[model samples]
Target: MALKSPRFASNAALQNAARSAPPIRRGANGQHVAAIQQAFIDLGLGMAISTKKAGKADGIFGGETESRVWQFQARMGLTRDGIVGRDTMAKLDELLPTAGPPPKPLPPAKMTHKINVHMRSIDNPTVPEFTQLKVMEEIYAQYLIRVDVLTGQSVGLTPGEQFTLNIVDGDCKWDQVSDEQRLLQNSGSNQGVGVNDIVVYFATVLREKNGETLQGCAGHAPTRPAVMIAASATDKTTMAHEVCHVLLSSSFTPVHVGEDANLMCSAPMCTGQPAYLSVAQLNRVFASKLLHKL
Candidate 1:
């Protein structure tokens, strides 16, 4: 069956309903809840919400609906409370109109790269693994490059490994291999990480020698190319930023760019901007040893 466009009296009405006592939460059933569910589906989140027998939004708020709400909240940087409150309602109102029909599937890409992610069990990353992968996929799709997750897993860490997880004084020295970095990168179980694949470690905390915390860093052993991401900094763009570092490598002079919208911009400045790459940067990325022609 075709998806029916969601109808609401008005954004004001939706907000009013969301502000009502008791709130619109799980187990509630009505057109309002269905509208929210349909909004998620329209936003290309159908895989997470469509579990009903008919595989459609059924005006029922169940486990699937609640999970979808949590995912949506995570994406919007809202509290993942699984409730449609004032804030969630506002975000829904702000984004729903832009949530047109999902894009048609694309043909096979001419170039591709594999990402091997090892997430620490203790890290408890803010953004979910699948969400992070989706973000990377969307950013790279613009360049006609396909980003594939070669392996993803949660692994426990030893006390010693946990203690030394932070990049110390000499760890960020990109010119030579650092022991601290090598130990951390090789601490977790290997997931068939290939020479050409980019390895990403979602650690509990990625700190600099100066005691400043970092969102993500592309520091790795000479042979093992990887990026370390702080659990708290797993926003939509951090992974992409670090991955760009790996692709650019040390040969690219001035690794960090000054443009806020560019992917290579320094942290915090690049926080909320739309990630973009220039023609010259794309040329550098395509020339990397890791990116392969499909």
Candidate 2:
């Protein structure tokens, strides 16, 4: 029997079928099967289904289609049952681009926070301070909050404070004060930082007593909020992460989360572009004294 080419009224129709259709397996034949096959092809999995010829997606679920389903399931870490069930369908929907209007822009900011930046004279960060501030603005904007730069300056460091700020024991305990951190925060280096403004210092290195290098830290003397960022660790998201630490404060237990998508995830592991803050984290951020009405 000659096979009929898969057909759909439109891409939206195909997407609808792929999303709402019931489970499909081998022996199935029609537009629903075709939708799934087409979705695979759309996701660059056409080679598995194109047995007869390239780009050929017949409205038939045979051995080739079943094999394709298995391959997709494995790739998505779903059960390799060769059936397009709810889980498999959901994964496909997530990967496929939506066919619809663009998302609406967020409304104006309702609240604002300020940051005071101080960079060591010898430090050269990979991500510039201005660019880092912009990234922070974008991340906080989701909560209708605006981040403003209160001040930015380059401070000359003494022989001891230059290049690397030695952290005692490499411990970032908020309650325990490290001499380096205390000196840096109280040594007038954070000049121009108001009580309500968060202070950020960019240093070339943040080395621990044990020879380990840290990307950044939020540890400071009691009642003094500050963030220290290492030049080597200044990715687009590091500043936000450290500032979030100060906002969250030592009272927030379980400071680090396991999910890489979260902003609180420890550095070198968090990979989310502009990592997101959870609802719980947002609540804490709003409660911080640094946040003020616009």
The lDDT for every candidate, in the order shown, is 0.64, 0.63
TM-score of each: 0.57, 0.59
Which whole-number lDDT from 0 to 100 does residue 272 have in model 1?
24
Task: Give the per-residue lDDT of model 1 (tens digit) for 1-294.
Answer: 112224444444355655644457877887678778887777655533343456767888765566567656656667766777767776666555344653442233343444344443346678765677777776676455678776677656677766776433334556364566566567665668778887777777765667787777787766777887777884668888888888888778778767555667665746323355654566677788888776
Clash totals, every prediction:
0, 0
Least accurate stretch of 10 residues (summed lDDT) in model 1?
A: 1-10
- Candidate 2 residues 150-266, lDDT tens each? 666676667676533533234566855567666666655666666767778776667777778888878876666778787777567888888888888789867987766567875
Determine which window of 10 residues in candidate 2 has minimal summed lDDT.
1-10
Off by over 4 Å in 2: 1-122, 160-170, 267-269
